[model samples]
Target: MSIQRLIFFVLSALFFIGSSVWIKDEISPKWIKYQKEYYKEQAIKVEKEYSAASSAKEKELLGRRLASLKRPVYEVKQILLKGDYSWDKRLNGDKVDRCITCHIDEEKLKEKHPNAKEFPFDIYGCAVCHGGIGRALNEKIAHKGIYYHKRQMEQRLVAAESLFEFWSELANLTPEESDPNQRLGMGDFKKYSITGDKAIYVGSKKCLKCHTGLTSPHVERWLRIKFKTFELVKEAPDYIAGNEGYRKTCLKCHTTGYDETTGRYSEEGVTCEACHGAGEVFSYFMDIGKALEGQKIAKVGTFGTPYNICGPCHHTRNHEMRLKFFQERGADDEWFFPQHTTPYKTGLTEKGDASKSLPKIY
Candidate 1:
């Protein structure tokens, strides 16, 4: 072939190859950048979701933030293991002195059990239950205790009362009766009757109504603090569960009444009457301008007040439910309630056991 003809053929072949490459290369660097941006956006979304979740249980699943951001465990070991040792370490956010200074309970320990061994009580050590990085000398690791590996909130330990309450709820559940594959028997409410006044069990909705437009600063602060994922879920509808605007967030505390449906609410916000006791009895006098006059309102504690109500749930301990009880019962159920509160009497009886519920300490 002539030189010009050969050159013409090579140019045509090169043009075809270039076209094929362009057709195959669908993904560009810009496309990769867009994907990275997409993931970053997703991460932000999960963080917001975690922040918006009201229930602790919900928070666990939704929590997408890095572990370091969560609340740090205020460890007692760092202080107790330190030279100036003590029993009760009343820790302040990651401070050795804060804990040791308050919990020098060796004097108390000695007074109570003269024969018992001294400080850094392995059984009674702050680290045993409340975790922190024990070996760390720095304030962050020392005071902000150890991470709870098995549990959701890796930082501090779950409150004892919270654990107990969870157990109590579990005890009340009847998966065996509800599910065909279930092996265990259902829990019974036969031992001690649920004796609280039916009037006291107001649902969360009643609280939300007044709370929504309440004038007080306290009410305003609470409204602001309450978690909601309306905005994020609005864009990603698939991620959300309920209606775009209205949904139940208040049910976390203001539990549903016995007659009421599980999620349904008769009122809005946490009503004053619910916390202060059934206004049916108390409010009668209050309406007549003599609330404190005729008869004292019926309540759970001695004075019929909130301190009693909040203590059982708020001032809860770590081992809310004593697992040993379940062990003693020989019940190998996976859904074991921690031995929180007097379980048996409150319809949370262990398998076959008939122990009465403990007295309310409030």
Candidate 2:
């Protein structure tokens, strides 16, 4: 061969070999080295086939076949800190998420829907309502990193027996003499209570951390309804002043916290886990980008949950439970209507939903 032709051929061969190595490195998952080698072998095989091609058309066909081979492309961001993140450049560079990759439909729905477009997923984040770790990339880490699922969690409650035992250390006090501050169910008993390995959901304490009485009607409304239960239960012949059956029943229809005695959680009012399922199990089975595009998935907490946050309480529990309580006590349901109502789920319920209700994060 001529000197110029030999040099050109050598350079071309080097370029081809270098490109194959680079391509394998870029695409390989790298857990196993052989997978990359397999791809390299396939590349070499194709190159050999191309070399043996007799005509320009055959070479072009081989080139097309090589191009058509399905290869997975992975895009990743090196997260140095919690604030470090990626953005979706295609949709206005608004925000970025692994969730968006799976929830394309929700992304479209949220982007396309008139009501949802204003409040994008990036702004609100999936964790607020869904209760999972938004910062995490994978299914196990993202979900496992969040706070324990309130419904399923066994929190440290001031057990009635434990309370009695402590109080018994002081004296055999009557219900009237019981200090409100020291009472098991009355005060912030969790401060004194010992947390267990198996945590269960205490009332709306988790919810009240953000949705305080100064801002919204959540705590105030709960207090009002809860007190009414006390007043009604006081009328019962078997009722003791400081004990908790009536309050427990009030929680039945009033709040969403789990009642261990009753297998069914009838009317869970608005709370974090009420809308979202337990935090630990949250995962994406498919592309999250589709979900955002308005396509729905069953794995996500919002749609996947067995209970509807509003439906059970609104349609049945709110109207039925309090009425049942009154009827059993020989009082008419009409009197209780003013005191107990079903307006809990009719309007907005979150801190962000209410004006200036959101807590300052700084």
Candidate 3:
């Protein structure tokens, strides 16, 4: 090879390596690490103070104060709230305003409420809760709600609880299911869910059943790639396949479930048990078409709990759990799946049709 060709090839190799790291890191859940530390510290400080206080009156007052200052464990500042988000706001309109400026003492809160100890870190900081100029005292600039601000701050503690409940349900288990050693559910609970179908377990076969001839960009892409779950299994084998010859590769795209008849799918693919929770319990409530009849869609669908529905699968925190793990299926890896080419599958429950609710933004 010519000297120029060699240099070009080396540079290309470096670029590929760099790109892989960036994508992996992007999918990894590092941001949560920082936020958890911050919350835990605050929670402990307040709990300690609350426990030590001898005066009941003082404790009551402290508890009230903490309740007012407490923020949600998640960072969703937009989806849950309205009004222009102005981190610059002093107190009014800004989501963060309600607590930091007013809470004279929060340490007493953590001490008083044992539940507070479960939070990831110390009390949420002033700037953390309120979006406005963190230390700014001016009301006019600080209270601005819209410009450059997040729309939701989750003022109600109940909202956080509700969100957690949704997530717990999505994992097909609850707080009881949380084992640090094992991978939980599929996505992140923090970001928005793609494709209105909150539940991805319906299987591509089901999707292809109705959408076989549907020619959309996404369909075209799937067809072009010949992205059949069975074919992928044939290409690269793994433990998910087990002694019976099934593959774990299916879990990469589908949710999980247990099949008593086959006994193999009992823990693989986008089974109903994964997103809708274990049917062993919730199956009674979920019948086809029942979700649409009610004013509030059944809790089993994506809209039932959009955040929790999307969070588990969307946010790829750990490497072993990310989608790329599926892409890296081949034994020698002679062929690699294109990172950007594979589009996520979606259905009716992901994000509701915006057109169904409002006029066009443009």
Per residue, candidate 1 scores C-alpha lDDT tens digits across 282-309 of 3333445653331344222224343434
TM-score of candidate 1 against the unseen true structure: 0.21
Q: Which 10 successive residues of model 2 have the least lDDT summed?
A: 187-196
How far out, in Å, is residue 291 in model 2? Answer: 36
**TM-score for each predicted model, relative to the true structure:** 0.21, 0.24, 0.24
Per residue, candidate 2 scores C-alpha lDDT tens digits across 1-362 of 99999999999999999999878755653323433444455667777898999999999988876664326233342212122223441223223344433333353445443334422454444443233544445556557534344333223112234322332322221122255433322111211211112113444454355458544774676555542443454444333322465555445444444555664452355444344332111112112233221112112224433343345544544445544543444443333344344333322223232323222110
Q: Rank all candidate structures by their lDDT, best first, as comma-separated numbers.
A: 2, 3, 1
> What is the Å distance of residue 278 in model 2 from its true position?
16
Q: After TM-score superposition, what is the CA distance of residue 190 in candidate 1 from its true location, in Å?
A: 21
Measured over all alpha carbons after superposition, the RMSD of each candidate to the real structure, in angstroms, is 28.5, 22.8, 26.6
Give all candidates' CA lDDT scores: 0.37, 0.40, 0.39
State how far residue 238 of model 3 sits from its true place (Å): 5.4
List residue ranges in candidate 3 displaced over 4 A: 1-227, 237-263, 266-291, 294-301, 304-338, 341-362
Off by more than 4 A, model 2: 1-21, 31-249, 253-317, 322-362
Clashes of each: 29, 42, 60
